[model samples]
Target chain A: MEQDPRDLEKAQAYWRENIRYVAILLAVWFLVSFGAGILFVDVLNGVRIGGFKLGFWFAQQGSMLVFVVLIFIYVWLMNRLDRKYQYDE
Target chain B: MDPWSVQTWTYILVAITFTLYIGIAVWSKARSTRDFYVAGGGVSPWANGMATAADWMSAASFISMAGIISFAGYDGAVYLMGWTGGYVLLALLLAPYLRKFGKFTVPDFIGDRYYSKQARLVAVACALLVSFTYVAGQMRGVGIVFSRFLEVDITSGVLIGMAIVLFYAVLGGMKGITYTQVAQYCVLICAFMIPAIFISIQMTGNPIPQWGFGSTLSDGSGMYLLDKLDGLSQELGFSAYTEGSKSRVDVLAITLALMVGTAGLPHVIIRFFTVKRVRDARKSAGLALLLIAVLYTTAPAVAVFARTNMIETVSNRPYDSMPEWFGKWEATGLIDFTDRNGDGVIQYVQDPERNELRIDRDIMVLANPEIARLPNWLVALVAAGGLAAALSTAAGLLLVISASVSHDLIKKTLRPGISEKGELRAARLSAVVAVAVAGYFGIHPPGFVAAVVALAFGLAAASFFPAIILGIFHKRMNREGAVAGMVAGVATMIFYILKFKFGVFDGGQAAAAGLTGDWWFGISPEGFGAVAMLVNFAVALVVMRFTAPPPAAVQDLVEDIRIPGGAREAGPAPH
Candidate 1:
């Protein structure tokens, strides 16, 4: 009933890789929602895009789009990572 | 029929749909203990995704969120950042491991991981606190929505919501709630989006609400909708729509607190466990986010559009010519107009106290779909959408309350010999009790729904998030450390909140600072979750390092949780 040591190692490696992708995605998340919306508000406000001041857009609309994109990208990367690690059950 | 007649029909339709959902749940009632708790582990990823969407999207999302965004303007980004950012942390750090642990409840995982019954009990207490606070808000929201549309008393409306939730949740358990939530998600999104589309088209000649937000308005103004909003806000002496008034450190801390607090919420975490596989958990999280984003993206647009339109059209309007919505909502006492100067015109502004309007912010968004003059049916759909958001989240939070009581308290502690069937009944009973308690709170309502919700998040962040995270990633966390951390977190947060909220410590309580100065590290009580979470981590780490390590059995359990396909090897251990 024991799991093969190699498979366990492979699973651990897959998890680590998955966590890495998540970390990268999270960095983008912080950038969009927090960095662009709040911290970079002054810098973003100086620039205008379409009808929205950039900072306002980031706060209201832009951060949301980034969040949606983050989720989809996560699914894609996790699926790929799962396949590579042979852990797609 | 007149529009009121149409609105009445819409109410009937929503009622019928809700009833059928519960009927379906009852017909498909869980047959086994596993079926009761985890839906027999057979739910499809997409379906589970829909259910998770229902669970995550609460009354706040449906009613208050858009309003918050509308009135708070740029500061509204806090809710957006906090709620959405939590999903990223959840997907990466929590969901996969929780699924691998293969438990029916959060306390189950905590108990098994720490090899201590006390850890489970502590988790139960936190879960109950968070869920009850959350469910009470939802029940109050449900009452408000129903009483507004159905012409019933708030108490009666709450009773109706309770009946609907209890019937399905008790019959089908998680399985029933899952399918019902899917339908509720569909109802809510359709209800929300249809009006948004109408309003966008009316205001900007744009049908797509999301993109129309940045498009030109009917004024032939070259400025985007957001640009127009900023100009108006400044004109009224309000802060700009996009710029924050809070210190940068405060914003960052609050945003982080909401994200981590959201990630640690037990009801939300339990949703992933219903899916069939680890991959499904990840996939479902994505789908839930997509469903949630549909509303999140449209909400700000609604806020900006509504704010501008209201200021331009209603401000300074003759009292007699006030729109029908004004008259109708006035009757409900939700919207009030007073001519302080006897000028017979309603002046809406933020400055000079004498000129400031006292309109409830909730009105700013709820009245949007109606203000834009969308179809009567679409208006009715908004009513239905609001109910779905409140009821679905209320149901999920109630279930967590039930699970903590039955699994963690009764079965684990008091009566270990109880049969599986007996435990199921206990869970149902627990749910009923939780509903009654929440309903009482709803009728009396301690504070505004938004404020109470913030307090709940603080409790969850301080008490639960660290323990769960440490239990999973760090093997050194012991029962004493976890319990002490939770106690410290909840105690500190409650004491601070009470000092301001109730003025319990009144005379020269300078340290508490009533409301203004009580914010630890500049984070408002609403945003204090981040501070509590950090405190929890520090306490747990400090306590555990000086304490003995958990027994070898606990270490193996931690090791076992990480490896997929090894659950069978661990076998069932007797208590």
Candidate 2:
């Protein structure tokens, strides 16, 4: 279980990058789902798209689509971070 | 088609699927305790994703969720937001690290991180309580599908479900459950989508239910489907499909509770442990969310379609000339028509004082094919799909419960000398007993099936989510803080539910009335868990500040768990 100091430093750096990515992604999640979908729904509802109020669509359909996309983005971002820090496995 | 043919089709489809599940169990039979516990950590990402989706979407999501949405209208968005939002938390905050921790169970992680058997025992109790509460709803879902589709009594239906779950779950363990769940994800998604696609095409000329939600109606008019639904809802005295009815604050609280609660659930969290690499855990979570979004997105569309179909088909129609589906459901007491004014026609309006047609929300998904005049075989397929959804979740919950009992309680704590084979046998025995208990509750369902399931999410959120997150992210979190936080969190949640939901400790009958205006800040029992979780965090932080920090070794363990390299194969821990 002995670790090289360099590997430890790399792991720490990797952890830092991972947390940064998580923070950015989660902020987007909250803004889209909670902010747009609920808190500011009325303002968005005034702007209609086809059959749905923009806010209503976000609450029911749009936020979920965004969530799926966000996860993929995290996956792609994390893979790169892993390789950068030599923790790709 | 006649009832006999429908019953025959249902029997054949269910039998084929059951046999397939058992065949998978035999094929993937566990060789060692590792295989039994975590599938030997060999599942591919996409396959694990599908299994996780199947495991997560229970009977409640498959059978009752759309029905609830159809009735609740915009308020139902709470479910849409809460259930799926938690996956974001799971992927970003918890799943990968826990997988890297390489434990057999959630309790195992808690125990090692806190370096206390007591902390593990508290988690075991919480996990069992949450899993037991959830399994009841799945069992009831099985019974509902059985009684309606197979014409069997509910008790018999539950027993049959018990036998099937017991066989596979006991024999194959996690390996069997994982493969069968992947199969179940296919059966259920197909079953769910075919009827939804049919109805969407009929109503909006859109084969994709997701698009059909926003598309214009098929009628010569260019009015959108949602616009038409709002008009219908207003005409019937119900809230508009896109408009909120509950207070915005309550909606926010409930959605947040569900989101955090979903993230904390042990059974769902356990799915991540079966994947091969830490990277796969992260990728599998994303993939699982994508698969789940397929059903989650389609559900609202199905709700809209089914609601519109019900109104047009039955509203203002004479009882004597009602559609075949209406009469069929009425025979089972799921649909009731009473013309109090002696009028021959049924008035399916929103007027509670004068409405003649009463429909149970649970029937919406189960009867959607019949309501839309879809083929008989497809109706039978929905039955099989509902069974798959219920059985997959039921088996998953049973496994978690059995593991808690046999591994966490007996071998880890009581009989440390037990051999690996003896532990595996104990796990299987515990699973059988767990199935029997779940089956009994399914037969005599504790009141509030959906509400009870919601409470399970709340408990998970309040108790485990905080503890596990702190265990990983807050290295200073000690055994005293973790254990105390769980007890306080769970106690507050249970007390709130019992007081508000069951009237426990209340002096008067009026006080016992559930979901009343008297609720604290209008927060329903289902939404109170979010508040309790906050309380848990506050208490834990304060307690930890006063107590000594965890040992340096525990801190090192936390740091090791955070890295993505070197996921150890999860096996029975060395005593």
Candidate 3:
């Protein structure tokens, strides 16, 4: 069967939301990895939690955990968007 | 340390793992071109996750990364963050879309999206360059482990490893490779974690490695492990463990290059193709990162544990009183002890002239367990684990190289009318040749093996990242724009690497050695990929504006891939 041409607008909206979600998640990605992990590392290292320097923790451990979380969050967000947009497998 | 029984443990474990792998390979051997190419387009997210992790975490990271971290201190975070952070991009930006496109290789996506044979050919070249360079290093890693631990020569070790990897990959194709990789992941992760957990509990009284590195030492000193490490490091005239010697800009650039390059890697990207649905692709990317994080996070902790354990065991100690591991490493020529002060004591201070002990950075992981005096069987397990990591990575890369030759060049470009059975045979034959070439490099590696491997990431970042991103994101991107961008990006990258890494263009070796002052924006060759990627984007955008947009059919193809719902007939995407 042919695609419903009326669904074209829906496709556009889906693409727009996908782009927005990607942009937001990538910003978080940059903030954790490049920002906390690198740029503001020295400033944050001044603060400590338990035995860990905040910046050092972010660089070695915190950023990687955040990265893993970010992907799953994207997956959850995207899957929900697919449902709302009526896109299926 | 033993010549029998426990050393016999290494033999028994290695033999059993290999036999199990062979059994798995034969059981799952590919019967069709589809199975050989994309594993029949059937893989669960969890299983694919393990396979992706195993495919990417090579022996270099398994055996050498912790050692590099021990020496580089905070600067080592470049690798820790750079390597793992790429998954964020892959999962969010690349994997699902690529899976929706539903192709066997990266070049297939590039070729179809851009709708150009030239684009496809350029991609094939880039894929070969990246995969071959990567596989050579993995082959050497396998050889080194066998020679060091199992008392075999490097050639024999590489040949034996090659035969096993070739058996599975050639016969089973991606399907065989995927299942074998999952099993390898299980074996290697257990071997890695067993030692790490033991050492963590011993040192910090914490069972978890991530917590163990940060917690206070259990020695009644009441000081955090990191704080103590910093103090000890400073006492020995080295930089504090929490501080880095690299400029922040250099670190930032290097980390970005690695992250971008990791997303662009063909073998890692292709792992997404084996999964059934777009959502599975996304979920598996997340799962892969979780599995990999288990090692990436523990690596820095292992660095701390090993460095502290090593210094306490060796520094200022009598040479005659050194442990058996030290002597064993010395015989391997990895550790050198000289009495510069004529005191017969090991002086391992950071100061060059006064230092009497020289230890290679690659020895840290292998030696860490021995220094901790863990079980002999545990040490042997590390060797087996290293082999698994190296072999898994090598096999994955070989598949990419083989597919690029057979599917992209032979089947698509040169011989489109070839039958499915003929194409499958071609793929298997190409895999054999690829392994032999990679094996030859392992035995007599080029003098510049390390440099070439480092540049593989840079070249990948420069070329493929832009082409693929623009292909999916910018439907107006035509063949002229994509081809020109790829060429410009790769040329820029090659020029930078040659001038900075090899001193080829203007500065000879002398100038290259001290070329830190000559860096463009203070970025080293290792960090140059980010700059080249920017050049690619700029060139492509400018060229696309001046050139014609792609045909209606290709634009529709782009729209179809972006949506999740159906197969190829998505009408037209609103521009």
Of the true interface contacts, what fraction does each candidate have? 0.66, 0.79, 0.91
Going through the candidates in order, what is chain B's TM-score?
A: 0.95, 0.98, 0.97
Cα-based lDDT at residue B232, candidate 3: 90
Q: List the residue pairs that clash in candidate 2.
A: none
Worst 10 residues of 3 chain B by lDDT: B566-575
Give the clashing residue pairs of candidate 1, or none.
Answer: A51-B224
RMSD of 2: 1.6
lDDT tens readout by residue for model 1, A1-89: 36589866886786578668877998898898888988888899888877777887887778877877887788788777767766566
TM-score of each: 0.94, 0.98, 0.97
Q: Which stretches of candidate 2 lie over 4 Å from their true place?
A: A1-4, B1-4, B511-515, B573-575
- Residue B557 local lDDT, model 2: 94
Tell me how much of the true interface, by contacts, candidate 1 captures: 0.66
RMSD of each: 2.6, 1.6, 2.8
lDDT for each candidate structure: 0.79, 0.90, 0.90
Residue B330, candidate 2: alpha-carbon lDDT: 90
lDDT of 2 by residue, B190-274 (tens): 9999999999999999899989889998887989998998999899888788996988888888999999999999999999999
TM-score of chain A for the candidates in order shown:
0.94, 0.95, 0.92
- What clash count goes with each model? 1, 0, 0
Model with the higher TM-score, candidate 1 or 3: 3
TM-score of candidate 1 against the unseen true structure: 0.94
Q: Order the candidates by TM-score, highest first.
A: 2, 3, 1
Q: How far is candidate 1 from the true structure (C-alpha RMSD, Å)?
A: 2.6
